[model samples]
Target: MPQFDSDPVFCSLLQGSSDSRGSFSIDMMDYSHSEQSYIRNSPVLVTVLHDKYGNSAQITDFAPRFKQYGRVFCPVMTIRQIKPLNGSPRICVRLRPIYEYGAAIPQITHGSNHVRYVGPDMILRLTTNYSINAILDEIPVVLDEGVTLILGPDETVPDSVTEVGQQFLNQTLDYWHDWTRSLAIPYEWQQEVIRAAITLKLNAFEDTGAIIAAMTTSIPESPDSGRNWDYRYCWLRDGYFVVSTLNRLGTTQTMEKYIRYLINISANSENNFLWPVYRINGMRNMEEQIVESLAGYRSMGPVRVGNQAAEQIQNDVYGDAILATAHVFFDERLEKPGDEVLFRILENLGEKAIEVYDKPDAGPWEFRATKRVHTYSSVMCWAACDRLARIAHHLGLDNRYEYWNSQAKDMHKLIYERSWNEKLNSFVGSFDGNELDASLLLLNELDFLEKNDPKFASTVDAIGEHLKEGNFLFRYIAKDDFGEPEYAFTICTFWYIDALTSLGRKQEARELFEELLSCANHLGLMSEHINPEDREMWGNYPQTYSMVGIINSAIRLSTSWSDAL
Candidate 1:
């Protein structure tokens, strides 16, 4: 029903169409392969253009098609568009790169490197490796008749400088097929798992190992309105889960790259104070700025470019980074080199944690106006100390053992005593107040309490009563002055699955896991949150935290299911 006046180049590449219910249906087979898996499998961006009779045209294209948008040039491989026979005012377009030399070409190829379609009110143009001059050449052709032109490069392209793109494509597919087939887990949920895995991989910027929180920036929390923020940078808290999830899925190489990214970022700290987050290229200063000129997604006002929270002292990051590194060391059987710089970094973190452990700072949520001694932050501090102590004991760093052990014990005691609210029968958000936080679920996962403990049960029950909405969970209760509460956080829902699994609620955990998996978009991507009423994704897209949650929950569910059998 809704339509665009003309299709933008970005929207003409989507591969699917919405049914009468407005539910988008996409075909995975047309877009999937292991080596090119992450790139080819993304949802085609779609835009609809309308004519005088209200007839709409659907435009779709892969993001890589916009290679000109980047400074580099790649080959154009494949681009195609389809329209409904009934003329429902929508056209479906799918674009991919041809990597294999002998691959079958559709009749639509039309024997030219570029293609153009002209209708009464709309003109569609798609070009590959066609010179920027050529692309620019066609713009006037469409605009002269008031027609719109959509254009971009195709994916899986070979290098424009070298003709090996076909060879690379073949090799990539072979590697992906072999690697995916080697997984120990059964593929009953293979389609979903592969889709999720590809989504996670795509979020990783290939040029830099730094994983972005999402691809697009400034998709508003409310409809074309408030709560716009950029998620293109790396959040240290997400690192632990992202690496852990990839490792669980048997993608050690990808996990290793992320570890390298971690090492690169962590090694840059000038003093004991490392940033809570960083830019994709390891830049420290991400001064938040509004892009006043461009209209945001759906006319969301004030398109933002940089993240302001990079400077904020989010205390949980210290623990999260250490915990993630420790998991990598443990899971990958990595030999601890006494001389590795990361070890020294851990030691420095331990020393810093001791100084700042008692201080009130921004917790995991990084609330703008308020700084509080958040319980989750303290719990993570305990976790950092615990990890450092264990690693030291394992590596025979006997000299540092006593100090770390003492600190860990002290933090554990403080969190248990001060962070718990006996009056509410739940763990409060911060030591200064009694508001329950969903993050307390981490207590069980951290093994701070036994699964069957009365306190743990009560805490879970309290969260279920207060925070759980249907199958999804909220991060925390709404605070009016803090910020807008937009949608249910995707990562929080996965955290719930993790917590439920730890508590031996295996059936409940699996059921919830399946339900959450259903929340993924057509390309198996997830945003930071989900709109409860409409089920549309909100917040950042292809969130690393959300994908990490999915992989972790899947592994947990599979392991538990196997043990029960």
Candidate 2:
């Protein structure tokens, strides 16, 4: 069972009481009053609810994050404030915390002003301004005034509840304002870009410079499709897109730290082989497992914990790892720029890319039971060498540059010869395979082919003819290990939009991009997959890949600020 199966906190109105139990009920809103909004552009959420009895309350929730001293201080604490707006709102607070994946219940203890739940491995302390006995005994309490709850590490809060909560909220709002001011957002869709940027920032694990694929696990791509997988760990390929997108927006700090993550992982590779995914702390191994005790999202079984992709042989990871690190060499904003040592480490990985550019392996899709010389993987291998040559030239290493350039030229010639089909007049998914895939649309973006290249336009046309479904694009129509995908992958639509824009189909691209933008949830957030017909998001929550698509598309399609003004 998942630890979250047990409701951690349930604070509701109190109507009646029995032996050691409280009955909670709220009258239906006869007047139908409720409002929800955010604090400016920040992540703070405030919801006001009103009942038919003229009882109203405002609930504010946010995670504390701000700059303290000279460094960013984002504690693991979350603050929730409940204040009465009208009438006497009597309520009860129920606190139940479980540990170890719902296998063990923690022992509860309380002090004068706080409650602590002690477990074997961790301790959670909840400091609130409510009555300690009322919460501990599950008794009813009067909500005549505002109440604050701070959940964090077991340590005591030094300041009073009201002072601490208000102070943190103000600071967090200011922090987001300052962060937003630094972004060079597009003239149009400024709010969308900012929201997507903040979402990407929240996905980043700053402690280790690893950005997670998503915050959720086992939220199946489609209902009961058995396609669920855990995405809590970091995929090198996803992180590359994330940092690259952020880099384009002039956010170099995230790119620099991700480069450090790449460097550390590459240095730790004893055999010069990189895993597709890793724990946020840089651990290379993640043993995938299923928790049968808890029902998955929508009562689907088999909630997964870790990811098995870490052990898979996905060759595209080499190119992704290098691509993420290449930014460190060219970006002058970085405090410690890439040096000769880092260049050499990348060269070792480039050598690996050269060895496996054409070999059969699990492609970028990571087919569980199939191995093919995927066109995307080979092109990425080509990219690894291609960027290395550029970096060598930047460092004034003539001989080294010549060597890498020669290698890239040879690989490029071989890839085009093997991957392109004369009959289709386009590049296929895998070498000699006649299927079209959305990834092939990135040929121009990757510089594998020039935008004016006739073959590139033909390839884009072929993809649009076959893979395009209304406003959405499928990753591929061909059946994989899980059979044909029922829903469209969110990022692929963005890629298609980008290809259309590059092909001078600005009107078409803009129309499709607007349709895709409507796919995001009410909070301007998106998931991994969406139903094209209904626009319902289905995969993992707040996917980094999907968020990257929003940022990149907005940047590509928006008019220049100078021209617009």
For all candidates in order, the CA lDDT equals 0.61, 0.83
Name model 1 segments beyond 4 Å from true.
1-168, 182-188, 332-341, 480-484, 559-565
- Among these predicted structures, which one has the highest lDDT? 2
Candidate 1 residue lDDT tens string, 107-136: 223224445433233333344432333332
Local error of candidate 2 at 48, Å?
Answer: 2.1
What TM-score does prediction 2 earn?
0.93
Q: What lDDT would candidate 2 get against the real structure?
A: 0.83
Q: Candidate 2 — which residues are off by over 4 angstroms?
A: 1-33, 90-92, 137-142
Steric clash count of candidate 2: 0
What tens digits encode model 2's per-residue C-alpha lDDT throughout 1-565? 1121112222111111211111112222344577877777788988777766877878888988999998888887778888888887666666666554444567888888999988777788989998889877877666889889887878889989989999999999999998888888998888888889888888887677888898777788988898888887789999999999998888887887788888899888977898899888888666877765446666764667687788888888889998888988898888898888889999999999999999988887788898899999999999999999999999999999999999999999999999999999999999999999899988899899999999999999999898878888889999988899899999999999999899899889999989999888778899999987888999888899998998898898999988998
The per-residue C-alpha lDDT of model 1 at residue 545 equals: 81
lDDT for position 117 in model 2? 82
Looking at candidate 2, what is the lDDT of residue 195? 89
